[model samples]
Target: MDERVTVLKKQIRAVVVAGGTDEITYQSEWLGYLPFPVDHWVEYQGKTFSGDFPFDWTLDDLASLERTGFLEKLEAYENPEDRFDRCIRYRVHIGCA
Candidate 1:
């Protein structure tokens, strides 16, 4: 067996011995699932935010969205922490594999 796998097994055993549940109901993914359909078009801060799913936020009016909390809850697929945070809604990058 691989060294990393052995180390992981030991860690799992430690957790289990400490009364921690090894059965993870929630597994972290590259993207998060959204319940609602994403709008193709959005008008914000006098700017037209239009595109497909997984819009490029870097080209958006981030200042306004940050102030208005429009996309505050949304996170990129490359960002794994926000997806597991559970404190806010996270959007998936639809185009990514």
Candidate 2:
């Protein structure tokens, strides 16, 4: 597994959660900016937020997510069969927004 990916994910999460402000909270923004689909809700920073599908994307688009390091963390685990959903969820939950 690529330790870099795991480290990056944690770094991203830390930066996001630390950006909270009185008027706007970045904790939820990550989940909304993801370039993929999601289900009913997302949970992060010890809280839960509702979610909706990003859109219906083509195979090429889905592939691009992986090609572009969008799924690097999940891929590093080397369990595609089990981590597919997790890959998407992590993308949605940790997107930089």
Q: In model 1, state the lDDT of residue 88.
A: 22
Question: TM-score: which candidate is best?
Answer: 1
User: Whole-model lDDT for model 2 versus the true structure?
Assistant: 0.35
The digit string of per-residue lDDT tens for model 1 on 1-97 reads 3343333334323433454322211112323457643222332222332332133432233323334332233433323455343222222222221
Which of the numbered candidates is closest to the native, going by highest lDDT? 2
In candidate 1, which residue ranges exceed 4 Å CA deviation? 20-22, 31-97
Tens-digit lDDT track of model 2 for 1-97: 2444344345445544565521111121123345853332333443443222233422233334345554332321224453333322344244532
Candidate 2 has which clashing residue pairs, if any? none
Work out candidate 1's RMSD over C-alphas: 20.2
Quote each prediction's TM-score.
0.27, 0.24
